[model samples]
Target chain A: MRVLGIDPGLTRCGVGVVDGAVGRTLTLVAAGAVRTPADEELPARLLGVEQGIEQWLDDYRPDAVAVERVFAQHNVRTVMGTAQAGAIAVVCAARRGLPVALHTPSEVKAAITGSGRADKAQVGAMVARILRLDGPPRPADAADAVALAICHLWRGSAQAHLARARQEFARRIETARQAHGL
Target chain B: MRVLGIDPGLTRCGVGVVDGAVGRTLTLVAAGAVRTPADEELPARLLGVEQGIEQWLDDYRPDAVAVERVFAQHNVRTVMGTAQAGAIAVVCAARRGLPVALHTPSEVKAAITGSGRADKAQVGAMVARILRLDGPPRPADAADAVALAICHLWRGSAQAHLARARQEFARRIETARQAHGL
Candidate 1:
């Protein structure tokens, strides 16, 4: 399955695409960011974000989307920006009929660097090593996007397994109920 | 001066332009909304918002922009949409070199209805009365935008007065210090 991961922001958004089956190796397809001029009006900037996402969707066409969950903090401005970015990601995925999943920062870090508290530099270094890149992803947002994608790839398989188990259990229970003639 | 008031949202954004001066009457110049398909990709919707705002800016060329300030809320999804809308408005104003002011919901309601706790219908009715319109502004969001603009006009003048007072006070203090040689 091809999965697209996004780190959303009003001024700058980082995106990464990966392709692989559950419990198997995944390959990076493409990655980039959509940035708008800080001086531009809100509507124009929103258009830039829309145009950028459309371009990526058409080019990559990933099967699923993964985004980072917004965390509450003291900085109202920062929180607001993060929330906007998250909404944009959700709307984009919903429009495309792609299932979207949200992962926490710590979950992404743990999946990538074997530690939930791993710093950005550490996560970036690990991503570089795993993806076997020449250097770290520029602009921490981009690296984080990649890490988020990897986390989904790992956790998604486990989730799928649990879902299958639940289905099997339900089927057995139904069979037992029928046998009891109740 | 012409002031454009914007009520930002994910699916639809309401925009209203009004003509006013420091002491002159305010008149509605134009009002409308920019909407996007909910099923489209987030990026595409953002592009629509950008283009819509650009078209409005080109057509109206308002003197200033007034937008609602987003406060923290419990619903993550709702807050996300609000933040995105707010960011787009800010970016739009900044791009055109138009001064932008933000007002809280309570402030706008108080300005229009003489009470901050006024409901949407109440606020809309008051806005229509204040502007002497034949009917209320349809699609509550549009009326809200107009009310927000009115609030800015009133509060903006008050702010100007306060600023002048501060300047005069500072000047008096400087003159006194100089005369006393302290």
Candidate 2:
């Protein structure tokens, strides 16, 4: 399965796609940043972000999307812009009927580095190791997005497996009940 | 001129429209709310908001859009949703080249009731008086949106007049300069 991850921001929205399945080595499909000019008015900049996200969706067509869930613990104005950018990403993915997931920054880092408190450099090193890259993706932001995609692939596949197992168990119960003619 | 006002929220987005030019009696064009199910996932709900805002824009075709400027002082989670919703409206307006303005709750209150700290009832009352309504729009949320529209009309018209005057002055200066061959 291919997954797209977004580390959303107004000035630079990081986007990365990885092709992978459960317990499989992931392949980097694409990685880049979508940008809006700082001088542009807020509404126009927001529109630009939306257009960029749509372009990425058209180009990659990932089976699922993972976005960094925004939190309110940071700089107020910047966080607001980040949240808005994240929303645009979410809306774009949902419009196309693609599954969307959100992972906190720490969650993504932990997923990649086995520690929630891992710093950027550590997380980047681990991500490089996981994907067998000579180094992490050029920019730190894109690397973060790539890590988020890896996190989703790992978690989503596990959940899908559990769901399928549950379905199979229910089917067996129904079949046994019918065989008993009760 | 017509103005569309949006009070952004994830659960119940209030929308209102008003029609009037500078120094004229304003008419209440419409007032209502757009809703998204609370149980829906964040991405799906955000898409619903975008669709709702698009529908309002299509129906009203207002010259401008006025959305409540979201602040980070409120409940953290709710504020994030509000900010996201506000961004969607701003993007929709910008996409259509409609002038988009953000009015803070306090600023809207001050414009309508002569005091920034005026209570909701006071703002609603002033809105009803200005628009000649028996009472504020049925829901409090819609009333807030109507007030925002009125606030924008008053402010936007003054700005437009100033801009027009400046342009006309520049034209006269150019004409005088040409006559003098300067």
Candidate 3:
């Protein structure tokens, strides 16, 4: 399945697109950033971000979307911006009936670099090597977006398996309960 | 002018519409809440909010929108949700080229009541009186939404005046500079 990954930010929202499924060769589709002027008011800036994301969605038509889950542990101001920006991406994807998954920063790191504590450079290096690029995607935000896409391709498949297994287990339990009339 | 007020939340988003100017008697057009199930995922929850806000905007066609500004000082998790919910409202209004203003909680309270530190009950009572209602609007969220609408009718006017004054001052300074060839 094709996936669009978003690294949400108010000033610069990083975006990347990739095509792949479990045990499949990943194809790099796009990498870019949606930038809004810092001096603009919040409402206008958010609208700009929305338009940029919509353009990408219309251009790529990805089957699923992956967004970096925002955490509140950092600077309060920055955290709020991240959450707001992330909301725009989430709402856009959900509006289209697309499957949207949010992966935490550590999860993205570990999925790509095999270590949750991997620094930016290590993660960037891994993304480059995995994508078969000469170097990491230009601009750190683009690199992060690519990493997030790659992470989702790997982890989303695992999650799908786990969900299916849970459903099967629940069905078996219900069947046994009905058989005993309990 | 008609104004729509939004008190953003994840589970229940308060919404109200009022028609009035700063010195005019306020007319309540609508008061209600847009509720999303708590069990819903974040993306779907946000989409729910976006749809709710869009419905209001389409139904009322308000000249401006007033949304409660979110702060991050208390409860980081809750703050993120509030910010996210508020972003949906902001984006919806901005998409239509509508003027969107954000008022802090204290500002809304102070504009409706005599004190910024007014309790919820006091604010509710004042909102009922100012709007000449028999009682406050139903549900705390609905009451707050109405209060925010009234607050915007008052405070938003003052802000517009200040903005016009600043613009006029800048224009005069620019004219003087052009005359002096500076």
Report the CAPRI category for model 2: medium
Which pairs of residues have clashing backbones in candidate 2? none
Tens digits of lDDT, candidate 2, A1-87: 999999999999989999998777889999889999999888988999899999989998899999999999889889999998998
Candidate 1 runs further than 4 Å off: A1-6, A9-78, A85-126, A133-142, A148-182, B165-182
Per-candidate local distance difference test: 0.79, 0.91, 0.91
Any idea how many clashes model 1 has?
17
Number of the top TM-score candidate: 2
Q: Give the Å shift of residue A181 in candidate 2.
A: 13
* Residue B145 lDDT in candidate 3: 85
Tens-place lDDT digits, model 1, residues A10-111: 788888887777656777787778887889755566557766777888899988889888776536666776766666666567667788888888899989
Q: Arrange candidates by TM-score, descending.
A: 2, 3, 1
lDDT (tens digit, per residue) of candidate 3 on B1-182: 99999999999899999999856788989999988999999988998899999999999999989999999997887888889999999999999999998998899999988699999999989988987889888778888988888888898788878998999999999999999999
Interface RMSD of 3: 0.6
lDDT value for model 1: 0.79
Runs off by more than 4 Å, candidate 2: A164-182, B164-182
Interface RMSD list for the candidates: 5.7, 1.0, 0.6
